[model samples]
Structures are given as structure tokens and as C-alpha cells.
Target: MAGLLDIVDQAQAIACEDILKVDAFLNHQIDPELMQAIGAAFAQHFQNDQIDKILTVESSGIAPAVFTGLALHVPVVFARKLSGFYGENVKWLPFADMQNSWWISILITLVLMGLVSLLLALNGFFRK
Candidate 1:
């Protein structure tokens, strides 16, 4: 029987007596090809933009971020869930977000910074 998951997945073809299973793909079973396709799509869409690095959260965002990083030929950075242990080189910039306002602002700021860095690097590369 179709339920919330069917709606979420935007399923078009499903029998009335059939039960759709997404846990095997989305939740439990991690499909490498599916992940790559997702990353490729994102990379293709953002290819026109100047992207220096890819950033995402922990766990779920890791695979997509890694794929995007590979496609874009750049590094990926993920914010930790809880602060416990990190290497010295791993920069820890405290996120200041009150009512999610600061979080959005910070994300935009980082994207812009990355864009500028990418542009500058490209310009320098061409200058040689």
C-alpha cells in the first residue's frame, strides 16, 4: 500500500496491492551507481559555476559530497556532528546561527568565498 514514502519518492508506477520498499536503496542498501548518478547530476548542474570545494554534513551527506568532489576535481569538507576530537590542521569554525538566520548567511558566505578562490586560482593558472 502506498503511503508517505511513496509520496516522498514521487513514485509513478505502483500497484494498489503492492508495497514499495525504499529502505533497501535509500536507508539500508547503499547503491554506488545510484550515488554516482546523483553526484554526476549535481556536478553537471553546478558545472557552470566556479566551485572550489564541496561541503556537507556528516553521514548521509558524505557519499554525495565525495562524489561531487570527485566530479568537480576538488576537496570536500564535512562538519562534525559533535565536537570531541579533531586533528590540528582540521579547522574548527564555530557556526553562529540564531533561528537559522546565521546558518544560511554563513553558508552563502562560504560559497562565495569558494567561488572567489576558484576564480582566482583559474586566473593564476591561465597567467602562466
Candidate 2:
């Protein structure tokens, strides 16, 4: 008699040591199915916008970065955690990597803002 939302809530609340345990496969191990789903979601979210590239900080971001790049069919670039003098044409972005996945986190708010601006600018060009 429960609705879908209730089921989802229950699922989220359920605690299981076995299920909660982080295995080498689920995350770092790289399950192809999960990666594909992630990629699909990323592609769907960005479908309206023309994304030329995907960027993230180096390290654990590599996995999601690869999925996003596959979804966009574009090259993926990761910023090195350590920066050097004379940073060339590089801009800063904030992202979050829990579990120490990546050394840096590109702020989600800024990413969305940048994507919106990029889309708007591109839309203007296509109309010409």
C-alpha cells in the first residue's frame, strides 16, 4: 500500500552492514553497468547544452570524468592537484569528492552557472 516515494525513502533509511560496506568493485572497482548509467544521466542532464569538454580535478574524479566524457563523446581533462606558476588559460572550478576521492572539489553552483552561460551564448550563435 506504500507509494513509490515512500519505498524510496525506506530504501534510503534501511541500514545493512553488508550493503553499506564499500567494496573495491562498486566504486573504485568500476562496474560497467553503473558507469553506463552514470554516463547516461550526465548526458541527459547536459543534452540541451553543447558541451565541448569535461573537466575535473585529478585522482578519483577520473572515474566519473571518464563516464561523463563517454556520455559527451568528448575528451576529458583533469586539473592537476598541484598547480605551477604561469598557469595557462586555466580557470578554477569547485567540485566535491567525498571519501577522499579527489584532492579538489569544483563548486557545483559555479559549474551550473558556467554551463548556463555557455548554453545561452551558444544559442545566440546558432540563431544567427
Candidate 3:
């Protein structure tokens, strides 16, 4: 596994006196190899857990989350970020509404309930 500093060094950047931009690799255009390494590292840490799903925020997280999901042989569910523009209705339910605090609460509750249920099921399987 590459060290954190090594990864940082590999990152492309536009460094000014105090500011830096890593969009070329870290955010805007991702490096697949790095993402895979990241996913592998995360998977190694939680390998003991019976992970049924990989949940993450949209955009930047999708790539590594997908890699982790594949590593764990689980499904990936990313929360969508609402924008000013709303296109045609998609199939998946809206995971959150940033403008509405109540909606965020509901989403959190749902995610927690699902996780608890999954954990219980896994425990039962292990006990058998």
C-alpha cells in the first residue's frame, strides 16, 4: 500500500503560496489505480464485517465506493446531491433533501434501520 505522503506527492496540483488544487487526480479526473488501492485499504480494515452495502455521498465518492463494493461483493448506494436543476424523475428514491432538515433526519433513520437489520441477519447467520 502506498503511504499517505507518497499518494500526496503523486497527486497533481497547482500550488500557490498558500493554496493548492488537486482536481486533476483527486477530485475532477480520478486515477483508477489509486482508487483501487484506496478501496483495497478500506476493505482490509473492515474485512471482518459482513458488509451488504457500501453507502457514500455522490460525485467524488462514487469511484472508490464502487471499487470497495466490488471488493466486498456488495451493492453501492450513494446519496444524490440536489442541485438547482432537476431533470426527469429517476428510478431511485431521493436519498436526501439538503434544504430540508426533516428529510435529512428521515434519511439517516432509514439508513440506520437498514444497517441494524443487516447486522442482525449477519449475526444470526454466524451463530447458526
Best by lDDT: 3
Pairs with backbone N, CA or C atoms under 3 Å apart (clashes), candidate 1: none
Each model's total of backbone clashes = 0, 6, 0
Report every candidate's CA lDDT: 0.67, 0.61, 0.74
Task: Quote each prediction's TM-score.
Answer: 0.48, 0.45, 0.56
User: Predictions ranked by TM-score, top down?
Assistant: 3, 1, 2
Q: Which residue runs does candidate 3 get wrong by more than 4 Å?
A: 1-4, 12-21, 84-128
lDDT tens digits, residue span 1-128, model 3: 55544666666353766776657656888878878888888888889987878878888889989988888778888878687424346554465444785677677779986896689678873242
The segments of candidate 2 whose C-alpha lies over 4 angstroms from its true place after superposition are 1-27, 83-128
Candidate 1: Cα lDDT at 19: 61
Model 1 lDDT tens row, 1-128: 23334443663324455765544444555556666777787899999988887768777778878888888887887867676543345564444335786677678779986896698678873232
Against the true structure, candidate 2 reaches a TM-score of 0.45
